[model samples]
Target: MRILRTWECKIDKEIEKCKQQLNILSGVSTNRTTVLKIINDVKKHKDKALAKYSKLYDKAFLSPKDFRVKDNEIEEAYRKISLPFVKSIQRAITNIWTYQEHIRISKVSPLKTGGIVLDTLYSPLESVGVYVPGGAASYPSTVLMNAIPARAAGVNKIIMTTPPSKDGAIPPERLVAAKEAGIREIYKVGGAQAVAALAFGTETIPKVDKIVGPGNVFVTLAKKEIFGYAGIDMLAGPSEVLIIADDHANPSFVASDLLSQAEHAPGISMLVTFSELLVEQVTSELNRQITKLKRYADTKRCLKKFGVIILAKNIDECVEISNKLAPEHLQIMTQNPRALLCNIKHAGAIFLGSYTPVALGDYIAGPSHVLPTSGTARFSSGLSVNDFLKRSSVITYSRSALKTAYNDLAEISGAEGLDAHTRSVQIRLNSRSGF
Candidate 1:
């Protein structure tokens, strides 16, 4: 890893390069065009298109009957995994459920003043489609994080989709996790096509009210394109972590935490601190640790390409840089993590102290690991139970209340040249006296 002073002119160039790597554009690209074509093909051919794409992209040929995972398959998955592993998934489910229940949004009671009653009703979505990435590796934790919250929100139907392997089967661990999280309606499909199947519904897959989870560039682009057709969580990019450390921090722990995120292959890991010696120490530690990991080559490429070690003038400067980046995961390993937290304006998840690594949030931590990425934390938030629920405003006005506010309503509507709106209110008021 390269270390540089924050004041250097190269910092701006590096920041721009990072943003470009995020590829946060709606412009024309070969990938975007291909995704668009795939979406259109899926829309037109439906289940047949899904099968064709599965064969072409995933090299897994399947018929419509084989799209949804069978109950027998889930049972077989349970038998394949160890009992202790199943128990661990169950334990994690409890933790996630407990946290989601505490934070679940509640319906507000009617607020009555004079004769007007205003209220809001919160209701769970009837159905939701969760996209769990598969193919190279299984993300069972993602199943727990996304489905548990939806279940807690009282979502009646939760449908899940993942890419099938060359053998045209979902991973056993993923199936086990989905079953433990109370998600039985799972389909063996993935990628942009899976997203399309969820949005538009094939003969085998049922269309859902909302879609959630993380995927690669093509999947993210598919979500962006089909957003209006079906509600979607944020368009997630590659995983990233920014650590704000100090001289008092542990270099080994810092290096380990950074590698934990970098192991995601395309992930970005950064360190910002005032201690020059700590920078050198963490660099050495990262070099020492990177060689022993299974994903050593991929993680090293990620660190070298997207990672950075910044030498700030002071702790305040460290916080300043962190806020500007608005990273998906922010770890504060300073002398006083809490004191610096108030200064952090944007971050998907904040991990305080050296012991609280981003990995905790990724797996067992109460908060959903699905978070905003690529500076989107400045305006968005992590996934939660609220994402599976919809809120509707309720307005009730009695005759007296309508009469009292008639002129104000008319004035506002008339100002906007909306004569029909003004007249609608006036007619109601006029009828109050038995006209």
Candidate 2:
């Protein structure tokens, strides 16, 4: 990994390049074009397009009838996985449920004005689809994080879609997690095609009101394209972490946290510190740790390409740089981590102290791991129960209220050249109950 001073001109150029890379539709790359074509095909052919892409991309051949995973298969998945694994998933579910329940919005609240009663109602979406990335690896945690919140919000139908292995089977762990999270409907399909199937219904997969989860560039692009057809969580990109540490922070722990994110292959890992000695120690530790990892080649490449250690003037400078980056995961291992949090304006999730690593948050720390990535933390938030609920305003005005406010309403409507709006209010005010 390269070390540079924060004031260097090269840092500005590299940051700009990172911003451009995050833009899925900024340039017409081959990947973007392919995703567009897949979305169009799925929109036109529906189930036929899903089968074609599943075979072509996933090498899993299946017809529309074979799309949804059978109930017997879910039961078999439980039988295949070990008891210890199941117990851990159940524990994590409890943690996630507790967190989601605390954050859930109240069903209804009313605000009474002088004569009008303004009420707000929060209703769960009829159905929601969660995309769990599978194939080479499995993420039961993703299922728990995405499904538990929707269930807490009282969503009627919770659907899950994941890519099948070359043998055309979803991972046993993923299936078990879905079942524990209260998801009954799961489809063995993935990629941009799966996203399209959920947005625009097919023969087997049902159309959902909203879709949430993280995926590859193709899936992200697909979500962007079908956004209007259905509500979507934030458009996520590759995983990333930014650490602000002091000299007191342990070099070994910092290196381990950085490598945890780097092992994600395309993930970005960065450290900004005021102590030059700590930087050297962490850099040496990273080299030693990388040799031991199974994904050494890819992790090393990621560190070289996207990783950096910056020498900041002080802790305030470190905070400034972090706000500018708005990383998906922020770790503060300084002597006073809490004091630094006040200056942190943007970050999807914050991990404090050396003991609290990003892995804890990713697996069992209660918060959903599907965070806003690629500087999107500045505007968006991580997935939660609120994402599955829709808010609508309820206005009730009495006849006397209309009579008192009609002149002012008509004047404003007339100023905007909306005669029909003015007439509608005037007609109400001129009715028998107007007095």
Cα error of candidate 2 at position 77, Å: 1.3
Please give me the total number of clashing residue pairs in predicted model 2: 0
Return the TM-score for candidate 2, rounded to 2 decimals.
0.96
Per-candidate clashes, comma-separated = 0, 0
**C-alpha positional error of residue 146 in candidate 2 after TM-score superposition, expressed in Å:** 1.0
Residue 170, model 1: lDDT of 89
Cα lDDT tens digits for candidate 2, 316-411:
888988888888999999998998888999999999998999999998989889898888899989988888888999998988787788889988
| TM-score of each predicted structure versus truth | 0.97, 0.96
Name the candidate that leads on TM-score: 1
Candidate 1, residue 257: how far the Cα is off, in Å: 0.8
Native-referenced Cα lDDT, model 2: 0.89
Question: Candidate 2 at 86: error in angstroms?
Answer: 0.7
